[model samples]
Target: MKTSSPSDAPRPGHSSVAALLQSQGALIALVSILLFGALRYDNFIGWQNVSDVLSNSSKFGLIAVGMAFVIMSGGIDLSVGTVAVLSSVLAARYSNYGIAPGIAAGIVVGLLAGLVNGVLIARFRLMPFIVTLCTYIAARGLALIISDRQTVSISYEHGFDTVGQGDFLALPIPLWIAAAIVLAGALLLRYARFGRAVLAVGGNEEAARLMGLPVVKVKIGVYVISGALAGLAGVIVASQTSGSPTEGVGWELIAIASVVVGGTLLTGGQGSVLNTVTGVLLLSVILNLINFENGYTGGAHLTLGSYWQTIARGLFLLAVILLQSRLARRSP
Candidate 1:
């Protein structure tokens, strides 16, 4: 009888405490930041600020959710940010036609880009990093070509801008959209067959193949998802502001950071969508606190806004990563 080694094959819900901490660590950090901000700044926790934070984080949320799935599949997507840039430009350029057409155009751009990536990686067996990097460059160039190197402005007659600006039940529409996406992602990862296959593939591609799991299909599927979501994020960006080929530069780092901070292992397999969302919020809150700090300092260091944000986000992410390592070691 070949018995499964406990270390090699953990049962479901194994190391519940460690798992709990790994998932909840970001939540705890977010709460701590909020409390600290509240104590130091007037109206720091005000509803208006809260709403704005949610709205601002929504774009990253969409991208990050897709990123989490890709990471869980033991792959990476450097093209997502640029794909979003392409989608935003497409969305803006098509806005004059009508809302539905504009939205469709953006989604189509994303879908097509994702399909290319999927085909290249899964079919050709190319390195995901290289394939996505090529896309990162190609998408940006395409966006620039389409927009004539200018921001693609949207016509407001179709009210397509409502996606980024409108409110629903007193909350931002973007928030609702992001929330819906997050919920769907969580449900799919938690209960769907495709989700299980994804985990299996990430856990061990060769073993998953031996078990008759469709490894090619899953790989292609994840890239498509990452590309499509990135495109959707671009649409949101165009709606909120304008689409520029330069918009999503370095944004992929944000998605990777969010995934990592949320306890999604870089090595793949184990992850949580909800925790990824928490990571997004946590980073957003950290940026918000930076703004609050500047205000408290009377804007004496306003010039350091971007630099400070990078520093703060980096430090927080580092902390979460360290915490994740510790918790992983503690897990049985």
Candidate 2:
């Protein structure tokens, strides 16, 4: 037998290093931010601060989970945020008609928007980017029209307010809702046949189709699901804010960043929903820590504000893209 080289041994050290970089970016980021905040601010880790972070995380967390599903299916949904805004507007409009109708209207709008995106991409072979962009604009315009460019308040609806604003054992209802969604998403991704079809299609559409997968239906379904989740998030935000159409602008970017930062590939096919949850929590914690630290430093919380968060998220996307590109190059 040929003599074994030192490099051929198991390379445990190298493997560990690779695993760390591959799976721990969000965790590392979370830890670094926590340590920095704890050192820089005395109250950063207090229960109040912890609650604040989770509350903030719930909103984008829900959106990010849905976006994860869409991204995993080899697509994107630029329209999610705008569709959310549109749904919120509709929700507020129908609140006077009763809670059931309002809730129904919001979900229906979301599903319809997703259907538009899915049909365009799956059936017409249109690019997801262009299709979603068009829907984004259309949704925003529709929202503005419905609200008459005004803010509609739903403070009178006790049930609606409870969905968005109530607390459960001292935690916001949205957090519980988000956690449930995350768990459901994990199950779907891990065990559902439809979920497997999504992964297969994303991995190689031609091969997946050749293997008799319902590639087109799965693609469309995920987009629809993504839109529905976004819509649900909008309703929650509206309830939390006491009903506001302006709640969802720019949220799509945050959702996209959370999904990507959590290790979901923009190129699609491989990622974990649970990892995406970690990514959302990490960002939320970092931003909350920044605000807490800013107060200690005697700086305005609104000064640099979320601008730094946006910058950090962009850098994260760039880094993951570079790292993944390297992995792809080395794979052959």
Candidate 3:
């Protein structure tokens, strides 16, 4: 008889009802929201709006994809946002050289940062939260110092302008890049041996270790993936708005929220990258719906402030978590 891996062992909170809801609820909500928007708002599902939504969500999607891997492995990286800012500054400073150089430099820096985080956590056995938190603080500070606490405008030389501004198949280039990354991530999670290892590591590290899994390598790899994606997001930011010392501030929160809302447990393991994407899209659509509401009602539906959207995001996350909790409690 086949034996269950440590992660797959019978345990509390693995309730079938809760698990099913977590796995399927996010998609259902997303579909319902889309239907509502399509009915209530004119052209809500139109191509141009869809393009804009996808473009705006692409950067976050990248970060969330990496974050998903980290979380699924029962780890967290608080530095992703600040890492993106650091990479953005680097990319902008080197933009005069050429498109490829700038992009490469940014991604390389991100990889290095991730490697540092991985070593500190896996090799040194430091707590992931504390290690990543320190990295977050340091990365942001370095970004500010390197940029002189100012925005570094890109030269846009050597076809560098095409990255963010370009389009393919009527979709934004950033969206295309983000899509490729997400697809790659999905493939890694679905069919790769490493994917199973990651879930196992997250589900029960000690058990996985007993099974002879390369726990250290798995931990290191997830962080590297997170850092690489953060770097890519930074390059996109530089392409769109140049590099600001302040870019990507608090982006980690957005990534976390998106993942959680997508039904990924904060405890790690038992999650889906595809659901994460749906969560990203759902949040984006909510923002879009909010804007449409305000436009249609001439500000009657919402207060006149940017913070409302933040509040909405917060409320949405809270609601989903509560529902998940209630369902989890109902698990028998």
Better of 2 and 3 by lDDT: 3
Best-fitting candidate, measured by lDDT?
1
lDDT of each: 0.89, 0.81, 0.88
Report the error of model 1 at residue 103, Å: 0.9
In model 2, which runs have C-alpha deviations exceeding 4 angstroms? 1-10, 297-309, 316-332
Kindly list the per-residue Cα lDDT of model 1 for residues 1-332, writing each as its tens digit: 98868676655576787777777888889889999888878888999999999999999999999999999999999998999999999999998998888778888899899899999999999999999999999999999999999998998999989989999999999999999999999999999998999899899999999999999999999988888888889888999998888898788999999998898988889898999999999989988888877778544444347876798779778988898789888677
Compared with the true structure, the alpha-carbon lDDT of candidate 2 equals 0.81
- TM-score (all chains, Cα) for each model: 0.92, 0.89, 0.91
Show where candidate 3 strays beyond 4 Å.
Answer: 1-19, 298-300
Give each model's clash number: 0, 0, 0
Error of 3 at 223 (Å): 0.3
Q: What are the clashing pairs of model 3?
A: none
Tens digit of lDDT per residue, candidate 3, span 1-332?
99879876545655775667856677777888899888777888999998899998999999999999999999999999999999999998898999989999899999999999998999999999999999999999999999999999987667665787788887899999998999999999999989899999999999999999999999999999999999999998888888898878779998998898888888887788989998888888888888887777523355435797778867876887788777766665
Location of the lowest summed lDDT over 10 successive residues in candidate 1: 295-304
lDDT of 1 at 13: 70
On the 0 to 100 scale, the lDDT of residue 154 in model 2 is: 71
- Candidate 2, which ten residues in sequence have the lowest lDDT sum? 323-332
